[model samples]
Target: MKGAALDTPHIAFVGAGNMASSIIGGLIASGHSATCITAADPFPASLERLRKSAPVAVYNDNAEAARSADIVILAVKPQIMAEATDSIAAVVRSNNAVVISIAAGVTIASMQARLGPEAAIVRCMPNTPALLQHGASGLFGNDNCSAQQRDFAQRVLSAVGITCWVDSEQELDAITALSGSGPAYFFLFIEAMIDAGQALGLNADIATKLALQTSLGASQMALQSDVDLAELRRRVTSPGGTTECAVQSFEQSGLRKIVATAMHAAADRAAEMAREMG
Candidate 1:
């Protein structure tokens, strides 16, 4: 709120799984006081893990974590969100706290209906990359949420990585397919490249290292360089050179079209899940 307030707000995570841990880790790393954060998880193992690194209190019940927190993040799986919210609905409703839901396929209307009308809800789709503090999160807020509430959510999300806001909740499915599921696609590509390198006589370890670093360097360049991808490709691909040959092979194999088709399929499935959940 108010153009990114620097104050460390009290935050609570409803689920202390990997994404929640990543967010808590990023928040602490970014100078948020550990005491300002609390995590609730049903699993004893997860609570133990969170307690080891976070000075914040950990609870087995979601309602206990939501009791005194200004912001409550719902990080449970989509299928279990309704039960998770139901477990803490009374507390959240009583406090009128802002609820940020990261469960895919759970709509804002559904969340509000479950949590209560006065609940300020923000829906976000963040990928696994958040585990590495390089996530891309897409967020959208319901009418109950004020500008301040939205800003608070954005600030918390931005602590981990880039954050983008969408005008319509429907577009969240697209965002889910793009950013939420995009990392796995990149990982698959990296795996394939590693395999190809190994087939070309490189050792497994060397191939994996080269492939991973190449992906990282390429992504970094795209983020930092002013040049467009097409120009960059052309710069590296001389006529009839090795890079050009590889590019031609990829084109011939319809790699670009395949990627586009795959993304579209992912988006379609996400939309279907949203509809099903609704």
Candidate 2:
């Protein structure tokens, strides 16, 4: 570790895209020296952007970056993970580095095939909110991963936001449906709310601001309060009140069923991607 503490591990990112940049920025902001971080991307523009934020070493070759790192984060797309792993597999194995992947739909089994069975692997599903340091990540480790590696993976992810470990690989599919695709679900709801607000004569800017702030406040309240979400909603919904009327309308329209179906569809798609990519 060039710029980190004596025990801090040198982290290398195999992709220098938005997610990778988010993690790197979070890490640097949290006191991890930029010199201790390395980013590898095929695109010059990507590396340029990362450099503008943090003066981390940039590499065009994944293997070269992986060769000297203690932890290698596979931030590339699931479709390209196989190719990326192939390039750095030997270096990672020889160095006994922990491999943490944020690539959606790429399973531990799929990665093991390329990185070798002995490789310590942790697969995580993180949403776009990570860029804003408000993300929630779901992590799952393979049998080869040690406690230390798991902890290291958690620490790396915690830079951006909250992290939780799931016991089984299958649970990752459900996690993917929940938090992985959860941001888009909230965005869709916000969009609808804004459109309705505008329909009611509010300007677009006012509608958007109101919708966004309400969403943020509601989320913050849910996080800070001990009360259950249902109860919290109930607290705002008095009998025969406007809130109750709106809630009734949502229920009458089968909002709950629609949400459940959409989540199930997302989970099914996650599993399908694993099968296809595996």
Candidate 3:
């Protein structure tokens, strides 16, 4: 990718939490100058840590961070979004900068209502894998956002990982379930696999290492291979083999049904949070 398209844009992070740190790391890794970005957090320790890694400026006030930024990112917790936005709303609205929010359960409309009708809002949901630059982000732009604004948002988000754009804001809740909360499900599976391996006589350390690597290799293959997962699995599971034994156990345990149920519950909870926020 050409560096010109990603030149510093006077970006500001309203909350320098984990997600914000991931994005900041991605931006710097993607050729953006640390001097172009600024972050704000109330905690002195967080600010000190951010300052050590990047040449970016740090502020204790959200409004100070947003004052001159071309793109302002709100990375605070959803429950505190109102308070955070309220602190910087005046400056952000006055600047008319494009605002990208990673706060789960906060809608673009809610941000717009707080920032102003003219605010160009993009709502994003990125999972925890973002910390490793393997994130899956779902982006939805409000009507007021221009194509350039959307592209800019996509560029910034793509720095962290893969990005998908959604047409309807409502789909963000589903994205939250599939991508935002998806890592935990996979981690849970890995934990169970390691435990089962240990129960089968492997040492704890060996079981953990084997389970993690297996999961990684399988996921990489599933992503890179053109063949379907079912086909791949079928090729591996020879008749009456150990793999088949495990497959049968999983089938008998209703693993697929359990996963579906869990994902549905996550989606339902996201929807409930959205409704409650209103």
TM-scores of all predicted structures: 0.94, 0.96, 0.94
The runs of at least 3 residues in candidate 3 whose Cα sits more than 4 Å from the true structure, single-residue gaps closed, are: 1-7
lDDT (0 to 1) per candidate: 0.87, 0.90, 0.87
Q: Give the Å shift of residue 241 in candidate 1.
A: 1.0
Q: List model 2 lDDT by residue over 41-123, tens digit each.
A: 99999999999988899999998877678789999988899899999999888878889999988888888988998999999
Candidate 2: C-alpha RMSD to true structure equals 2.1
lDDT winner between 1 and 2, please give it: 2
Kindly give the stretch of ten consecutive residues in candidate 1 with the minimal lDDT sum: 1-10
Provide the lDDT at 154 for model 1.
95
Clashes of each: 0, 0, 0
lDDT for model 3 = 0.87
Question: What are the root-mean-square deviations of the candidates from the true structure over C-alphas?
Answer: 2.3, 2.1, 2.8
Error of 3 at 156 (Å): 1.2
| Model 3 lDDT per residue over 1-278, tens place | 11124456778998888888889999999988888899999999988888876778999999998777878899998888998878878877676678899988887778778888888899999998998899999999998887877888998899899999999998998899899999999899899999998998999999999999999999998999899999999989999999999899999999899988998999999989988886
